[model samples]
Target: MKLFQYDNFPQVTGSRVSLRQILETDIKDLIEISFYDAIRAETVQQAAEMQSKINQDYLDGNSIHWGIVDNANHNIVGTCGYYRGLDKGEGELGCVLLSQYYGQGYMTEGMSLAIDFGLHTLGLKRIWAATGQQNGPAIKLLERLNFVKTADLNDDEIEYELQK
Candidate 1:
C-alpha cells in the first residue's frame, strides 16, 4: 500500500523499532526528545508547535513523519521522516532521537526502513540528509547508510545523499 493512505501514517516495523504516525498522545514524549533535536523546545507550547507542524505538513501532502518507538517497551524514542518534507517527489531524510536512546542503533534501523520505503514504495531516485557539522553521530549514520557527501548547506550544516 502507498504511504500516507491511512488515517494514521504507515507503520514500518523493524527488529528494534517501529515507525508510525506521531499521535496527539505522543506530545509529552516529543517534548523530551526536543532537547536533543536541532531546535530546542522547553515548553509545551514550543513542543506542540513542532508536533503540529509535522502533522500539518503531512496533511497538506508534504511528507511522512513517524514517531520512532522502541519495540521492546513501546516507548516513543524519536522521530524520522523521508523526502525532507517533500511531497514524495524529492529525496531527503531527517530524524531526531532522544539523547538517552542515542548510539543504540535505533535510528540506523529506523532510517533504513524509511529509506527502503522511499525506494520500494515511493520509487525515489536518491535520498539525502542534511545535518549539523557538530552532529558526529548523525554524520556517521549517513555515511554508514552509504550516503555520499553532497554539499555544504552552510557553515554549520553538511549534506549527504544515497543514490538508488
Candidate 2:
C-alpha cells in the first residue's frame, strides 16, 4: 500500500517529544547522530548517503521516517519510522536515539506514536523490528510495547513483532 500520499506529513506528539517530518536542515544533526556507535555512519560521505536515502525512500513510497525531536529545545534527538515490508499487510519499525537520550523514555514515546500510525492509519496487520541482540534497552522497550520475540535474524540480531 502507498502510505505517504500526504501534502503535510502527520506529526505525532507526546509530552516530551514529537515525531515530525525529516527536514533538509536536519542534515547536520543527522550526521552527528550517525557518529554514535549504535548508528555508525562514520564519515561525512556516509552520513550524506544516509540522509539521501531517507529523503528518497519517502519519495519512493517505501517508508515514512520522522525525526524524534525534543519539544522544549526543538533538537532532533533521534529518529523512528516504518518501512513497507515485502508482505502487503506488514511494515518494519526502526528507531535510533543518541546515547544521552537512551534511558529517558523518549524513544519509547516516539515509538508509540509511530506504531499507532502504522497500525491505525496505515492499516497494517503487523509491525515488526529487528535489533542487535546486544541492544538490551531496545529489546526491553519493544517488549514493553507488546512486541513478541519471534526469531533470531542472525547471531547479532533478534526480531520482534506486534500484531494488529
Candidate 3:
C-alpha cells in the first residue's frame, strides 16, 4: 500500500455504485458517461483507444482508474482515479459523471468509495482535487466529502485537499 504500487485497480462496492476497472466491453458505456472527463470520446473506438492509454499508465505503475458503475442497472455512470505523485504519499483525485446522473448522490457515493480506497488501501497521506470555481456541484460535493478548500490556483480553478 504505497504510492503508485497497485497493478490491478481494486474493485469496491457501495450501496449505489461499484468502482472497478473499465473493461473492453465497457467502452461504449464509457463514451456515454464521459462529460467532464479530460478526454472525450464520441465513439467506442475512441473510448477504447483512450482507455488503452490509461490502462498502459496503470500497467506502467503510474496511475489508477476506476469505472463508476451503478449497481441498479449495472451500467457505467462515471469514472474516477488517482494521479500518483511519485513516492510522496499523496495523489490527485479526479472524477466525472454523465450529466443525466447529476444531483442523484451517485457521484457522492462514488467519490466516497474512491476516497476511502485512496486513503485506507493506497496509504496516501493526502488526496487533492482541483475543480473550476464555476462548478457548483463539484465544489459542494468536495465540501460534503470533508475535503478542505486549500487554495485558489487561479481565478477560475480552485483546489481542495483531504488528509488522514
Candidate 4:
C-alpha cells in the first residue's frame, strides 16, 4: 500500500494508556528515549535517524507513524508506524519503547492499535514486522497479537506477518 498520514491513526484506549499519531514536538522525547541505553547507542542512533526521516515522510505524505503515550502522565513511551512495502497489499510495522516502560503492557496495546488501523482503516491486506531474534518481549507481543512467523532470516532476526 502507499504510505499515508496517521492523523487518522486509531485512538485506542486501554486500561492505562492511549495511542495517537506522532507529533512534531515528539522528536525531543524520542531523542531522549533513544539515549537511555549505552550498549544500544549505535543501533539507537540509526533508528533515531530513520525515525526523523519517517517523521519528515509523514509530513510529506509518505507514511504513517504514531507515538504511544501514557494517558495519565501524557509522557511518550514509544513509537509505531507502517512503512509502505513493495506490494500494494503489504506494509511494514515497527515500534520501540523507552527503557523505563519496558515490561509494561504498553507496546502490546500500541501495536494492536497499529495493526488494526492498518488493516481496517488503511486497507492493507498484509502487515509484517521484524525484530531482533533476541527481542523476546517484542516477539511475545507480536505473537500474542496473532502475528505468525512467516520467515526466519537468521538467528538475529525473525519476520512475522498478519494477513487480513
Candidate 5:
C-alpha cells in the first residue's frame, strides 16, 4: 500500500478504551505523562518536542498515533501507535499508559485494537515492539498479545514481533 494513503486517523474502539487521533486538547494530559518521573522527566520544551514528533510522524506517513482515552471519563490516559518500519510491509508498535492504569488491562485492549488496525486496515504484514529489558509489565502485555521476542536491541532493550 502507498504511504499516507489514509486520509483520516482511524478511531478504534475497544471495550474499555478508545483509540483516536491525539488532539490539541490532549496536550495537557501528555505533558502530565511526560512529567511523571517513572515515564520521562520531560521539561515543557521536551514534552513539546515529543508532541511535535508525533504530529510530524502522522503527517509524514511514518506513523499513526492515538490518544488512549477512557470510555467512562473521556480522559486521555496514554498514547499508542504503529511506527512505520524500514520495510513498508511492517511497523513498530508502541504505547504508554498512566502509571495508575498499569496492570488494569486497559493498555492490552488499546494495543489489541491498534494491532488490528495495522494488520487488517493498514495491510501490514508485521507489527513489532521494543521495551526495556526490565519493563516486566510491558513484556507480559506483549507476550499475552502473542508477540514473540525476536531480538535483543541492547542491554536495556528487547524487541518483539507479531506477524499476520
Candidate 6:
C-alpha cells in the first residue's frame, strides 16, 4: 500500500484525555516512559530501542503516534497510535500508559477517539489490534470495541480485526 502523507496533522480529545500528534515537545514524555521500568516489564522491551522506534516511525510513513495526555493535570500519561502496515485502509492500535492511570479508563477513551479519526477522517476501512493473550485489560478493551479475534499469531498474542 502507498503511504498517506499529510501536510498537517490532527488532534483528538475526550473528557479525560487529549491526543496530539507527537512532536519534539513531547520527547520528554517519551523519555520518561523510557525510564519507566513498569512499562518495560509489561511490554517486555527495552526503553532505548522503543524510544528509537517511536522516533523512526514519525520520520517514516509507517505509523502515526500520539501523545495521550491527562486533561486535569495536563501531563502526558501515555502513548497511542496506528502503526502503518498490514493492508491498505488497515492499521494497528497500541498504547502504553503510566501504571498510576491503569484503572481510570483513560486509555480506552483515547483509543476510541483514535479509531474514529482513522475511520471517519483518515478513511480507514479496517483497524486491527494485537495484544498478548495474557493481557486481559487490552483484550477486554478491544472486545468492548467489537474487534474480533481472528487467530493466535504466536505465543500469547492474539490478532483482532475491525472491518468498516
The candidate that achieves the highest lDDT relative to the unseen native structure:
3
Q: What CA RMSD would candidate 6 show?
A: 4.2
* lDDT by residue (tens digit), candidate 3, 1-164: 33354445689999889999988987776686543246567887788888888887777766788999999999888898886663677788888898788888988999999989878887778899999999998999999998888999976899999845
Which residue pairs show collisions in model 5? none
Residue 26, model 6: lDDT of 59
Whose lDDT is higher: candidate 1's or candidate 4's? Answer: 1
lDDT of 4 by residue, 1-164 (tens): 23454455446666667777666566656764442212233454555665667656666655666788888898999977775572466678888898889988888888888777777777787889888889888888888988888998866799998845
Q: Choose 2 or 5, whichever is better by lDDT.
A: 2
lDDT of each: 0.79, 0.81, 0.82, 0.72, 0.80, 0.74
Residues 100-144, model 1: lDDT tens digits: 888889989999999998888767776888988898888899999
What is candidate 6's lDDT per residue for 1-164, written digit by digit as tens? 33666666668878888988665555654664553322442232454456567656655666777888888988787888887553476788777777777878888888888899888877787888888989998888888887899889877789988755
Which 10-residue window in model 3 sums to the lowest lDDT? 1-10
lDDT of 5 by residue, 1-164 (tens): 23755567779998889999878667766775652213463566667667777777677777788889999999888888876582477888888888778777889889999988887887787789999999999999999999999999866899999844
Candidate 2 per-residue lDDT, tens place, 1-164, comes to 34557877778888889999877777666765653224668666777777677767777777778999999999898998876582476788988887777788889889998898888887888899998999889899999999999998867899999845
> Where is the poorest 10-residue window by lDDT in model 5?
34-43
State which candidate, 2 or 6, has the greater lDDT. 2
Runs with alpha carbons beyond 4 Å of true place in candidate 1: 1-7, 35-39, 83-88
The C-alpha RMSD in Å for every predicted model, in order, reads: 3.1, 2.8, 2.6, 4.4, 3.1, 4.2
Model 4 steric clash pairs? 1-88
> Each candidate's TM vs. the true structure?
0.86, 0.87, 0.88, 0.76, 0.87, 0.79
lDDT for model 4 comes to 0.72
Model 2, runs deviating above 4 Å? 1-3, 35-39
